[model samples]
Target: MAVLQVLTTSVAVALLWVVVESIRRLFFHPISHIPGPRLAALTWWYEFYYDVVLPGKYIFKIQELHLEYGPILRITPDEIHINDVGFLDTVYTGLRDKYEYPLRALRVPGGVGATADAKLHKLRREALVPFFSKRNVLSLQHLVTEKVNQLSEIVASHAKEESQINLSDLFFAFSNEVRGEISGIMKVQSSGTDGKSDRNPTEKEAVYESVLLNESLPPQERTLTRLEQEGALLALAGTESPSLSLSIIFYHLLANPSILDRLRTQLETVPVDASWTQLEKLPYLMAVIEEGNRLSFGVTARIGRRAYEELIFTPSSYANTPGTGTPNTEKSYKIPARTPLSISTLSAHTAESVFPDPFTFDPERWLGESGRERKRFQMAFTKGSRKCLGIELSNAELCLVIAALVRSFEMTLYETDARDVSFEHDYQIAMPKMGSQGVRATVKFRV
Candidate 1:
């Protein structure tokens, strides 16, 4: 009888707590006034259903939620997702600390991308800045060209035999090998795709020197464990986005002969082996790259940030944008200090107001004076203090590889469609649908 009485009391207490907490969340929470589904505001299970159970569908669902609710949505009990390109600067600005809940998903707390505190992220980013600078990436361009040459030779061999190749896998391998070589710029000798290191990397970087000798950094920041974490993040960041973007660019070039012909004509303006710096001058090539990056949606996950100070959002006067953030922007939203906020790449890229007919692979949109206005809304590498560090390296790789492949080969898509390259699942970076044979093609030497 005593055991039964104890069980009854515990059950009663649990129910009471749930009821009280739900009431407080629905009414008494500081952001209870923000508009969204009551279920989303009450529990994180709603997001878990979309992102986890549905396998990274939360970002898409959030866009749907914006149509019913206003521009500012209390996506979670603690987070706000604003779907406006015009409000990009406000959400990802100075002194913005990353939201801890989502950073946990990255599981690389020591890496610069996963650093939460703005000050610490700045410190970590500064240490590695020299290696990724425009000048440094330019110096390393030869290493990239060498890799591209090897890849083209492989393609030539495949073409000679009239065999199809998985360009996605090839591009992915090229990125890995090139990145291993580029690490040499930092004096860190990492083995290429084969994962066989001839010599141990000497301590040349301060972070390596400090961590190896146990001399600097606080305990939490400078452990061998955190060093491994940073390495893992770098390996991923260097490989995935660039490979995906390259595959997307090639797929589009093959599908549209007019685009390929135009780009090839531009390529002819320079030497047969023009450098990336020279290729960068081609307006059409640059525009094609911009369009591909948009479709690839670099870093597809919705990365959220919380500001140290209050932020005010007034939507751009872009009116009546169906299936976008502009549908409900009659009023300004005053977000309190330390609120978790984000302008996801999905929303930013597909904002019909910014990039009309956003789905179409239209390079013309990025061509003239209008293109300059459209540049602010291009968040493929994101914005603010935390923008992608490998931007220069990625650009160099894309320019060189795409130029070499297009100028050299006449390739046709083999059993591939838009679904093969389109963003279907988001595993941090975008993944296409299940059973995706990443961007297959049959190639032959250009006549």
Candidate 2:
């Protein structure tokens, strides 16, 4: 009876502690004044429920929260999310020292993308800059062309068989193979009389060898383990996002016949051997690519950063002057040092004011002088110093492979639903709805 009484007392004490802590978080926390769901203010489980339990739905939920609470809201107990377009440049760019939120589960310790310290990230990024430069990517055009041709041939074979091609898988394979070739993972013959001779060298051998061969690397940074880590990081970074974008682009093109015809008409002017440089110059084609990126939801999570020093955020007129102040003005809010903040690219890309009829797949929206101006708001590749290192390479692949596919075949959805191509979940990267067959299509080889 005494032991039972002690157990009851402990349970009562635990419940009391929880209630007191909840009260403090709701009423006394530094961010409590910033309006948000009461549960979110009290505990992180509110975020975990949407991001974890529902999977990618938090992105949509965030949009709904902005409708209820305003442009700025406490997304988590410790983090604030801004839904205004004007603040993206300020937050992602500039001379401020920013540290990514320390979610160790999402980070690969010691990897380039996971390097949180500003100085260290700079050093790591500098070591790889030469390999991913625009000049280097242009030099590697043949490698991209080769993979595109291979993908076309596979599509042709599938067309002949009348089989549905899983574009998601197809794009992923093409991306992986192209990365392999560019990184010199695939074998290449050297200048030698006997091709089998031991003296013959392969093309740079591996990305690790090429990157570390530079005399610029510090002695401590040249370790084999670091090379392996960076290589794995580059491989994943180089493939997934671009492949996902390609799948969505094709899905959109196939869904809209008139747009597909317009794209094909534009492509008819390009010679069979046209370079990506030339292809990139075609206005309508470029618009299609931009539209694809805008709709793709690339890296569709809130990329959070903590300030090493005080950070100031100024909201746009839409956010600041909602019947309470003058229109088309800005209001500044000073954020304390070490406060977590983020701008969701997914939200930014779909802002109705920035891109009118934001939900529609309209390549025409990306044309003309006004369209060019709106491109400034497109954060598909993100912005600032920590922007994607593989941007040039990814763009090259998107142009070459997409052009090749459109030029070589006519594609249509096969036993595929609209939801299959929709952005259903956010797993850091955007995912099509669950149970999706993954953008399947039938193809007919163009004569």
Candidate 3:
């Protein structure tokens, strides 16, 4: 009995050793071939700590890793970082269908923004695209212009009183109003001046920010009406559409004075009575907005694609071949059916090869003939067939508001540290921290 016991113990110890060693080898060895910290070799905690626990440091951490380890680095057993523009174009633009965004439930509830399957994504895009169609977005120009005028009036009122205004807060107010009006879902008003009537209902009234974020119970009217209001409010709150992109552009303009001056000069060139119909003619204004997008990306946390079937990221003017910046027609990565591949846009946008001086904010690279030349490289609205439906709408709105803004206000940055305001980003969305003075520019109306 004693002899049998001793033999059994020895076998058990050997098996345990093999199991532990295997886990270590699987995580550390295979990915060990890829560059990254040795800690990443042991566990994904290395990435989790920096990305989640640290405030506004995910981009910096990833940038640091790529700087040390080249474009491809291992963050975890399932995730690898691709920083090269070629890799980005290949994976994000080229093999766009291969990646799926895993964290959609947090934003758009009821799986409205969630599309793991490419076919579902296609259907959703098709359904949503018409709403943001060029004709539709253009048709709503008067409405957008009205909202802009209201917003400007509110800020201009404060300027007249010489009262310090939080422009950052006002930007959100304006964005919420525009998004609400266009989506035809919610009404958010932010200017809080009461006990007086000055402008139309659309102009002087204040709407709560809660309209965009939370649901409101209407006063008892009718059973069906109340129920319908509850449902609509819930749906609006649940929709996982990200709106940080609007803030990104706003902050970019507030920080760069020269860029503001140039934009204003360009706006002056456009006729005073110009409308959204005239947006296409002002290429420089469009370029500035696009450049802001390039510098300030909203979706950098995670991207992946759920495979409907076995798919390959083949080279054919889309994929970047390994070790060669040159794109290949051959399939590079073999993605298994139902697999999800993640990407980091922060890494992709800052790649030096794609845009020279990638860190600097320069709109000229994307303006006029020069801008036309780089059309193939633009990914502000993303690429491929499933691109953003609101591209034209967003373009038109941005052009109208920005042009009007430059024409009306002379902006001077109020805070120097504001430029350093970083992104408090997570898996799917990024936004400025509450009360961030990133855009404390005083708006002096241009006479």
Model 1 spans with C-alpha error above 4 angstroms: 177-222, 323-327
- What is candidate 2's lDDT per residue for 1-447, written digit by digit as tens? 999999999999999999998988888776676768888888888888998887658878987887777777788878888877877776777543444554365456556776766677788888777667887778777778888888888998998977788998988888774334333421232222222334223222234555555667777676656765676667776777888888888888898889989988988898977899989988888898888888876667777766666867666753532334433343556777777777787778877667766768898988999789887788887777878888888888888887888888877798877677677788777777788878888888777
* Residue range 275-353, candidate 3, lDDT tens digits: 8777667767778777766665635555654435554443244233333445434324454555444446665565444
Candidate with the greatest TM-score versus the true structure: 1
TM-scores for candidates 1 onward, in order: 0.91, 0.87, 0.70
**1-447, model 1: which lDDT tens digit per residue?**
999999999999999999999999999887887889999999999999998998889889988888778577899998899877768887886789988898898888888899999999987777677667887777667778999999999999999987899999999998884333334323432322332244234312333433433433566765556767776787788888889999998888888899999999999899988898999999998899999888889888878888878777776755335654345556777788988988888888888887888888988899999987888888888898999988888889999998898888999999999898888787888788889998999998888
What local distance difference test score does each model get?
0.82, 0.75, 0.54
Which rank order by lDDT, best down to worst?
1, 2, 3
| Better structure of 1 and 2 per TM-score | 1
For model 1, give the 10-residue run with minimal summed lDDT: 188-197
Query: For all the candidates, what are their Cα RMSDs to the real structure?
Result: 4.3, 4.6, 8.9
Top candidate on lDDT is 1
